[model samples]
Target: MSILGSYLRLSAADLARAVEQPGWAEEFRDEQTEREELRAPSERRLHETGPAWDELAVLLGRCDLPADLVHGDRPLPGAEDWGYGPPRLLMPEQVAAVERRLADLPFDVLAAGLDPAELGDDDPHALDHLAAEYAALRTFLARTARYRHGLLVRYA
Candidate 1:
């Protein structure tokens, strides 16, 4: 089974609701990805970053970026394991903090530390693809901060 990373932008209001009723975040993801039929996925923005996210997260930790940005500060209150466990919820503040950290960090230099052997897929271009996803994720978080939105990160 291939592990994949997914992210969904949540308005402040939606983030509040998700925190109050954690299960809502999963339902929201199902709705968004399904509604889009995943058409124009790039336009869907950072909706999915593939499995490279796992390795990327490790790299982030090595760079001293807070682990909560990807692994999350806490898991949503829910019983659903779904193979990869419950989704991670990052509040608007957490999102902003991550964006701020990304500001000075030359992500490419950090990304170079990623170990090819640790990648989920054996594709030779995995690192390059991960790099692109990293750039997109940074942009996505920046946009999320612009609107003061939070994020829901899920893996499956």
Candidate 2:
């Protein structure tokens, strides 16, 4: 099965409620369903515990960011009811910190050191594909920070 990553943007108040009330996420999901606003932007997909996801997790680990930000293949706390897993909540500050780390990352430098062959594909663009996904993640985190919104991310 393929594991996908996605995020939801939530207001501070809602985020607080989610932290305070374990059941808030269920209610939020239901309300979103009622309002017909449940769609989340598609992020990326990989094997739940596969190399591609592991590689990204390793790189993120090197950056010394919060563990929750790049948690791999695990359901977040309280996300089980959503039928995926628990979602990782990135507060505005956490988003800003992650964005800063992403901005400082030298993609070309990292790419140069990566062996595409080890990525398990002969496709010449495997590194590019990973880079694009990383960029997308950065953009999402940055947007969440800029808007003072919390980010709810999950791998499912």
Best by TM-score: 1
Candidate 1 Cα deviation (angstroms), residue 104: 1.5
lDDT for each residue of candidate 2 in 1-156, tens digit (9 for 90 to 100): 756655666678877787777577656754653554344443221112333554566456555664356652233355554535576666767767777777777667556667877656688887787777667666766666677776666555
The TM-scores of all predictions, comma-separated, are 0.81, 0.68
Candidate 1 lDDT by residue in tens digits, 44-129: 52467777678777667766665477766677776377449887778888888888988777767776657666765688987777
Worst 10 residues of 1 by lDDT: 38-47
lDDT of 1: 0.74
